[model samples]
Target chain A: MNIQTKSQFVAVASITSELSAVMVVAKEISLAAANAKAIAFRAGDKAKGFQPITDFINELAKETIDLVTNINVYALSLYRLTVNEYRRTVAYNKFDLVVKTTEGVTYAQSMQAPLENAKISMQNCQRQFKRDVKQLLDQLEAVMHHARAARVIAANSRIEASQAGEYLQSLQAVAESVDKAAHTIHDNVQRCRIALSLYRNS
Target chain B: MKMTKIYEGSYQWIMFGRDANKPSNIIDSNQYAVRTANRCLLLEPGGSELFAPMMAAVLHHTPVDQITDLFASHQDPDVISSLGLWDQALSNAKLHAPAIWEGYLRHFGCESIEYVPIPDNGGTIKLDSVELQLIPAHYLHSPGNFHVYDHHAKILMSGDVGSAVEAPGAPMYVDNFDSHIEKMRYFHQRWMPSNQAKRAWIERVRNLDIDILAPQHGRVFKGDDVKRFLDWFDSLQVGIAV
Candidate 1:
């Protein structure tokens, strides 16, 4: 009920509402990417649907930043490290997903043989998008946890919140771990795409 | 009063009334409360200039649920004067106090807020982490005046019995008794000059191990000062038991 809690809740509700939109956009981009890959598999020649997915993914990234800023404003700073780490991972992964999906379409346009193989590569890129979205959702969950704990801290000092501080620290550690894991995946994929680009041109 | 870090969570001690530093005209003794619980509680919130400040502070502590409990030590306007504003913000918190003081709570246009009368003797309220016990203060200041006993903090927030005339910025705790004894005596003579009432309340206080003494008008007395104040009050006689 305190001002901090009230303000934080309003921001949380805003984030939740905004997340619905993000999810919808992400789903559209995924479907678009899938459709583009499906066309390349059938005809081995279309690259038009690919650009829309990349453009939409770009918009999603911008929206993601706006969401993070809102979270930071209402944030408790308890999970600052976790949020920052996840932010990096999500940003990197989203960037990788966009680059890879775009490259898969380019790969199809330039290559003549193994058309189905190019579609498979594009499908893998879409999977990367899904992975990044999951990471973002995980980060949002951690932020919500800290927000709730901060609310308890604001409402009354009588609460035993030192324990909650420990929990928040653990949340950061987990986020860092997830970030590192995702970073490795992202980097390996980026290098593979570079090699694939070198092999197939358009 | 030197506002100490008695306790604050996500809720900060926010003041919402106008010129809250000034002695309240609505209530003779001006004191403001910072409400941070899921359900904020207003103490002596009044219609005077203090109304807006109390609302702002309460608003800071209150979100969707509104005020949980509207509380006052007695029926005095200074204590329950702002009941009107609180009733509007958190219609469900309800106005609660002794039956005798019920009229004053209702006096603030009892449309939205529910009025609950505590037995003349006492009542217990369970807040989120703390429990509030209301003990009758009898005639120390008003008929319905009662001390709010916070068990966790070991504090007894008496209405006017402990207000001092020294600088308004007087310390709540008395690390040095001799330093504040004069001011304490001066205040007791003017405000709580009833020997019988003092004796009765002293016994009531003695039954509990009080760590702090938070008077409505002055600073809270903590640690040794709390014990010493009681001993001093025990020795004094006020106006032939009148």
Candidate 2:
């Protein structure tokens, strides 16, 4: 059975590992893009050069890192906030309605930054490009295409936020799971309130 | 404290890697001061806290001017980023190193130190009693990396090879060979890095007849365990399932 706490810890660690790799990749890519920028600025009507080739490869690596980091950070945040809301109900032994609502609300808020960053990086694919050259321009164009795709996927972050409301359907559905314990609902609410304040204030 | 085993070379010994238990602590990296009778050499002592934490360990006896050559095994932050920082500490420190990672040292701003290039075609240098053999072990961890050996001590500073991600109070040397081999076996199974690159370097290491293998990460490998670790390292495919 997938308990909430175990699921959250695994999610966080996985996100951290993915972020670490992306950070390394981003640095590699940044180096490449910087080198390519230096070369394209100085190509001087000469042949297509190895100097820019270094940059292009580095940029490719960075772009890969950027996409991974953005999504993971955002997703992990939502998961953290959403589940923290329910920690009280599990404690008071009230596996009922109110606890389910707030968790769903928290899950939706965590993805804001990653979704935004993905859009910004995709835009950089064009902003960082040099115009009018066939070879380098074509390569940048390909990079820009992928960046756009990332932005499109991140557009769904808001939709995920909207789904948060529906997940809190404990108003109608809570009576089914905890119906036998419905008589104790008043006691658990007070317990839930005290626990939630301790958590929120922290 | 146990007797400090002094390596006869000029090592700056900049420390790096997973260092720091407290919130406001310097990074966890150590610089090696490899000394010889006539001269002293400094190895990669990472940049962040090289002077405060690392030099505090060295400066109790000697000053920076005594250091002549600076050597970095590779371009890792835990390995060599402090080349520039060490140069700033010593006025006349020259960098003696492999050619592969020279650009990175320069990138870290080690312009004051003169670059001593090692010829890959094969060469040897004697710093008095200690004979230094520059064995190029590229891609065992990263590209352009090499390991330094002292035939006198029968020790090969193996860089990142033969490493284990052990915690504090971990054994430095094992008395029982079998249990030690298991540590190394598990270590290499997960972290040998690049296979194609390690194969060629393993061949070079086989010919060296080393006694002690001192890697940067975890415990140093010695005796029959050294051979066992090498054999285990050789048999496994590069990269770990874990």
Question: Candidate 2 residues B57-117, lDDT tens each?
Answer: 4433344455676666777776766554454445576776677667766776575688777
lDDT of 2 by residue, A19-135 (tens): 454355345434534543444345433313333333444444556555545545543553444333322222122211112322443222222332343345333432322121122
- The fraction of correct interface contacts reproduced by each prediction comes to 0.00, 0.00
Residue ranges of candidate 1 with Cα displaced over 4 Å: A1-202, B1-4, B8-37, B168-176, B240-242
| Per-residue lDDT of A96 in model 2 | 19
| Model 1 interface CAPRI class | incorrect
Taken over the whole model, the C-alpha lDDT of each candidate is: 0.50, 0.49
Report the C-alpha lDDT of model 1 over A143-169, residue by residue, as the tens digit.
Answer: 343333323322221121122333333
Query: Each model's TM-score, in the order given?
Result: 0.48, 0.47
Which ranges in model 2 have alpha carbons more than 4 Å from their true place? A1-202, B1-3, B6-30, B121-126, B175-191, B240-242
Q: What DockQ does each listed candidate score?
A: 0.00, 0.01
